[model samples]
Target chain A: LAKTTQPISMDSYEGQEVNITCSHNNIATNDYITWYQQFPSQGPRFIIQGYKTKVTNEVASLFIPADRKSSTLSLPRVSLSDTAVYYCLVGWRGGGNKLTFGTGTQLKVEL
Target chain B: EAGVAQSPRYKIIEKRQSVAFWCNPISGHATLYWYQQILGQGPKLLIQFQNNGVVDDSQLPKDRFSAERLKGVDSTLKIQPAKLEDSAVYLCASVPGQNTEAFFGQGTRLTVV
Candidate 1:
């Protein structure tokens, strides 16, 4: 399992974009980067995943640099409801998929 | 499709007592995971099972905590002689396959007094 480091917390206002970066210096070649969102009293929800380059979905976008040592999660036009803890995980796709999580970045979206 | 299901959304027990939690994963999900999340902290993986077989349990406290998935369907996690530190939310998550997204239940909050 690879370790990840992220900002402890971030503040954003409505209609602003939020980008949270994660660092995994020991990321393996077979590992994929994934982002999850967790609201209070709820389990984490998958937001986006990518192996390299950029991947976008209805919820968010994932940007992975060529080095694969770091990734960024981009949320556009945030709202107060978007306030949650964001986790970045790195793990293999198939066998022994042990995804490890860090303290996570708490994004506080305000009006 | 339904998401993961867990029972007894809340539980309170005295120290040295026993408690158990049940979980039902989404239909056709092969991988199931149990995690313990403390307040103000990220969830910690306790165990992982793939189709009724243990995949990883290195982080599980074998002496006081045990979990099993019989017939590869419903699962149960038990804690014996629980301590105050055992008070935390037990979360169950499952995925259809190795590469797919995982679905999580609301989780069982355990409070040990």
Candidate 2:
């Protein structure tokens, strides 16, 4: 099974860029790194997914180094609504792969 | 596009009673998942099903919890003689295909007293 570890919580101010890092030292060769964000009283929403290097989208950017042992999710110009729990997951591509979630990083963006 | 659908939105049952939750995955999705999210914790995978066949249930407490997917489209999770510890949010998710991101439903909040 693939396991991920990240900061239990984080704090930031509105308009500040927030970066949440996760470590998956034992990730397999075929695994992909994915991130999800969950707000209070709602299910998690997929933030981004990447295989390697830097993948940038409108909401965030994912940076995966050559080692692939760790990845970073960067949220630019965040607002109070960006406060949520973010999860990092490592899993294979096909064949009924499962995800084992960690405690996740609780990002609190204040005004 | 529809993400995922689950009901009832909230359910409260006394300990030793039974409760069931349902999930309808996005159209054409081939994989479904059931998760248990306790307060202040990440969602925990309880079971995984691919096209009506269970792929994993190692974390599920088989002594009390059970789940099934019909025709690989819809699923139901049941707790018999529910325990207070079972109070939490039951979440459902679906993946379109290999190497894709998952879409989650609003979830059913289960309270056992």
**Residue-pair clashes per candidate, as listed?**
0, 0
CA lDDT for candidate 1: 0.92
Could you give candidate 2's per-residue lDDT for residues A1-111 as a string of tens digits?
A: 678999999999999999999999998899999999999999999999899999999999999999999999999999999999999999886746686678999999999
User: Where does candidate 1 stray beyond 4 Å?
Assistant: none
User: Tens digit of lDDT per residue, candidate 1, span B25-96?
Assistant: 998888999999999899999999999999999999999999999999899999998999999999999987
Distance from true location, Cα of A45 in model 2, Å: 0.8
The TM-scores, one per candidate, come to: 0.98, 0.97
Candidate 1 docks with a DockQ of 0.63
For each candidate, the alpha-carbon lDDT, in order, equals 0.92, 0.93
Candidate 1 chain A weakest ten by summed lDDT: A92-101
